[model samples]
Structure formats: C-alpha cells, structure tokens
Target: MQNFSKALLSWFDVHGRHDLPWQQDKTPYRVWVSEIMLQQTQVQTVIPYYERFMTSFPTLQALAEADQESVLAHWAGLGYYARGRNLHKAAQTILQQHQGEFPSDFEAIVALPGIGRSTAGAILSIALQQRYPILDGNVKRVLSRYFAVEGWPGEKTVEAQLWSQAQMLTPLARFDDYTQAIMDLGATLCTRSKPRCDACPVAHGCAALAQGRVAEFPFSKPKKTLPVRRASFLMMLNQQRQLWLTRRPSPGIWGGLWSLPQFESREDLIAALNPSMQTTEDSPASLVKWEEFRHTFSHYHLQIEPHRLDRVQEAPAEWQGQWHDLDKAAQLGLPAPVKKLVEQLEKEDGQNG
Candidate 1:
C-alpha cells in the first residue's frame, strides 16, 4: 500500500465518519446521490436533504419513475438546480437504457447527465469496490496541499496534475475505505480554511505544511468582479391571496422551476399589468414597489426589484401561468429566492389576516 493511502486508512479506521446516511446503505445509487449532493455543498447541509430525498425515492427505479417537478421539489433548497434536473434525467436514462440498474462501468456511469469523472470514480470505488481515482473538490484540496501544487485547481493543467497525483496515491486494496478516507481527510482535517494539520494523518508528508503555505496551495480562481444584472419580479397577487407563477424554461438558471413573473424593468412589468395606462379604477394603479434585493449566482449578481400587484381578477393573457395559493406555491419546485419570497409573503399575509 502507498504510504499516503495507508496513513489515511489508518486514520479513517479510527476517526472517519462512518454513520452518514449514504454510508449506511453503501449502494451505488445511494453513493451517487450523496456524491452529487455533496458537490460544492457542505455535508452538514446535505444530510437533511439526503434523508428527505431518500425517503421520497429510495431506489434508482423509484427516482426514475418520479416526475421532474417532484424530484426538483425535493432539491429546492440545495441550490444548483441543474444538478437536480440532471439527476432526474440520469435516473430516467438508466431506467430506459440499463433497465433501472446503476451502470457498473466507469464510462457508462460518466455518460449519465450529472455524473462526472470524480463522481463516477466515487460511485464505483465506494459502492462497487472498484480501484479508481477521484479528483473531487475535497480530494483536490487534499492532494494539492499534500503535493504543494500551485495554480488554480480549475485550470486544465493544474487539474490534470492533481488527477495524476490522485491516481498515483490511490492504493490497490481496500479501495472503498481509501476513497472515503481521503474525502474525510479533506472534509474534516484538511479543510479549506483553518485546516487541522496537527491531526492530519498524513501531515508529516504534506508539502504545503512543510513549506508553511497550506492556504496557498490549490490556488484560487483568478479574481473577476461578478457583473451585476437587474430585473423586476412581478408578484401578481389576487383577491384570494393566490400568486401567479410561471415555470422557467429548461437548460438555464432556475430551469424547470416555478418562479414569479419576471421582466427586464419595472416599466415592462407595469406595461404588462396596465398596457394602455387607462385611468380606470381597476387599472392596477396601486402597484406597490417592494424593496429590491440581490441574489448572487455563480457568475453574476441579480439585483431583483419586486413589484406587488394586488386584487387582480385574472392573469395577463400573454402569461401562461397558474395562480397558486401562497402556501401551496411554496410546495412546488421553486428557485431558492422565489421560495423564500413566497414564504415571506405567506407569513405577512397570515399576520395581516
């Protein structure tokens, strides 16, 4: 066994997390779901989501049979809606192509909608006991510091180097435990900030620790100011306290999720509500402009100005949306901001009543 893997395994045997929900079943489906959820998200945050999701669809076949909205509703607060959408698509694909079986082959697994190189490796190693190297965020951080690798890990060259190191360090035996051990090492001791080097099993050989630059390895992405974009969300509420919501088109931000009617500007929103600006009593003259808030995406900042239109009898003819009770609307597959907004509005409505 490689010294690195041996040390990691020793530590894992003594201190690694063994009781995680996904660890309990150790099935490919469970491991795949857990891996996908863990992408760019903390384990603590994913625990409840994972448990709820497992309850909703315990088996790959069950997930395959579920609707996209139902699957996404289970993933509403997890962010990265595309992961949820792709997961649902992958499950359906497996059902159709693999007869509801999680593919055992690496290439076949990677071909799935959301499974990438690292995720595929993890699923195979942890669930199938296959000997494959993973280069997930946690692994990258661990390997980068171990080798004192310099450069943003996102760069192709840097990532390739890390992959090679990960491949070299992965041992021939106990592949499952080794896979989980390295991830635990990163998540627990070799953390992004304030790493516990003293407790790190392989700290003796960590190049970054030797060089006194543990934080500098796995260099950050080149800084770029995230551009800010503005939009107006039209919260059209009717007399029954029902809000109009439209499903966003797929393959984009908040894709396949329900959201409030959105326009490029407040004028466009007003024009939609009162196209002719006639001075009639029910011309939506009392449009209430709510305070604007910012919702940051991975690439940009969305400055959202919200407008509330009340006492409307009907939705705009052009908007093909449904009017849902505020509480009921929160139950649908909604974007995080939209879900929070719905809950906030619902709470205020209750107080007012």
Candidate 2:
C-alpha cells in the first residue's frame, strides 16, 4: 500500500490537475458538486458549467431555496437534466432534514436524491479526507488493469471484487491524494483507447501490461442499439415575434423543462393546431417555415419535425403557450436541442429579412 501510494502521488504531482476550481478549498460541498457534475461528463465540458453553477448556488441553502425553473435554466445546455433536478431536490432535503449541512455519514449521503455508493464515497474521501473506495469509470479501469480484473466491471460480481481491491489499496494516510492520483492516471494515462503506457508510473506493476492485455482487462460489454423515436414540435409564432412554448412533465426525458409543444405524429399535431376549423377553412393555416432535427439520447434517438405556424387561433390545453420575443425566449431555459432549433430559426429569419 505504501509503495502504491508513493508511486501514484509522485505521478500525480507532475501530471494531475492541481489547479481545478473545485480543488481550491477542497470543501465537502465543492467536491460533491464537481463529482456529481462530472458523472459521465467530460472535464473540459464541465468546467464552465461548474463555475457558473457554483456562482449561482454557492451553498446548499441557496440551492435548496432556489426555484426549480431557475435551477434548470442554469443547467439548460447541459444534457441529462435529471442531474440538476436531483441536485436541487437533494439540496432541499439536506436543508430540511440536516439543517443545511452535508451529511457526513455514507448511508445518509447515499440516501439523498441522485447520490449513489460511488458518489457518496467520493464526497467522503475527497472532501472529508476519509478512506472510502470509489468505483467510478476511471478508477474502475485503473484498478482493473492494475490487478488484471476479469468479467464486465458493470456486473455485480466483478464490481464486488474490484471494490475489495480498491479497499485494499486505499491508504489511510494521504487518502485524498491517492484518490485523485488514481483517477488522474486513468483519465490521462490509462485511457480507454490508446493508453500512454510508456509514461505510466505503475506500468511495470500492471498485470494487464505484463500480459499484453491493457485494454482486455477492463472487459467491454456489448453495445445496445438505441431505439429511434419520432415526434413533431409545434413552433407557434405570432406577428409580435414571440414564440409559443410549453413545459415538459416533471419526469422522463427533458423533465421539468420548457420546450416547444411535442406530439407523436404530424397528423396529430395538425389536428391539435386546427381543432374546430377543417383543413379547408376560408383562410388556410399559414406555415411560415418548417424543418427537422434529430437529438440522440442514451437509450433512444428522437426525430423531431419542427412545424412553424405563423398564425394560430388557440393553443391546446396541454400547452401553457405564451409568446416571448425571440431574444427573451432564449432566456426562458429551453433544452439545448430546442435552443438550437430557435437559433436556426433566428438565422433563417435574419437571412430572409
């Protein structure tokens, strides 16, 4: 354990990110925020968002009291909106149940919304300097390669073995540095593709390296094909330059966020748009523009056909439609794809005008 710690620390001093904003004071709250944001998100992509999030909700109390819409607005561009929702909920719980303090107990932390065993462990080890094992993707790859672990790490049996190994190597002293070091190594050196084995400090000690199986140790699981789903987005506009928008339901994809009205098919959408008057009304419905875009989710793909209606009589009951100036509408906290669609419309309008 001592030797392993020494090797990792020595490597981290030269290669690890020592100046990350979250590492400045190393508080439990700061570490917790960064850890949660970095889940399945890249470092470069998370930096700006993390800074803005911290600035807005600097403390648990601020986040707890913040409106759900405001929180989602801050997190608009960042996909996986559920993370932000869970974060807000967890903040409220901490404030109400724990008196505005982050729970130090592992079980208590895990009980919070969106927190899991690995995330709880990370908050404890990095923020509190406690010796807790983290089983995040990078750490899993590092440990699996170091010990030549077999089977898919996602499997419970394989993950249990890795957890035990992680516990064994976690040094009581310098636990924080050790935790950061291993993660850095995996992220930078022992990457999923094209690992920098020549410069790795523990390359000689890696069982997978000795066996010429650096990539094989962290076994890969078969990829599942994402199912394709289709939907229509009603881009309702008036002469006032304001666009109609609606709030999505509180759960499922794009949960609790504002977006254009979505329907299962174009025919259903047309029916909703023209409920009373038949398609052959005296004044035909004016469609100023129309376009289509695709947004991909983890488990599925969404084919969105945007139908732009220049004029409309009334909006459907499911939609809380209101018109805001295009610029103001941008500030209404629409999801990234919806925002992109609006930007495209703005560009087209500019070109036409």
- lDDT tens digits by residue: candidate 1, 1-353: 38889989999999999999999979999999999999989999999999999999999999999998999999999999879978988898899999998999999999888789999999999999999999988899998999999888888899999999999999998999999999999899998899999999998899999999997978888788576888999887877888989999898889889999998777557657754432246554468888899999999999999887777777756777899987798899999888878888888888988
lDDT (Cα, tens digit) per residue for candidate 2, span 87-166 = 98889889999999999999999998889988998889888988898989999999899999988898789999999988
Against the reference, the lDDT scores of all candidates come to 0.88, 0.83
Global CA lDDT of candidate 1, please? Answer: 0.88
Q: Candidate 2: which stretches are off by over 4 Å?
A: 223-353
* Candidate 1 regions with alpha-carbon error over 4 angstroms: 224-353
Q: Lowest summed lDDT over 10 consecutive residues: which window, candidate 2?
A: 274-283
Which candidate has the top score in TM-score? 1
Instruction: Provide TM-scores for the models.
Output: 0.65, 0.64
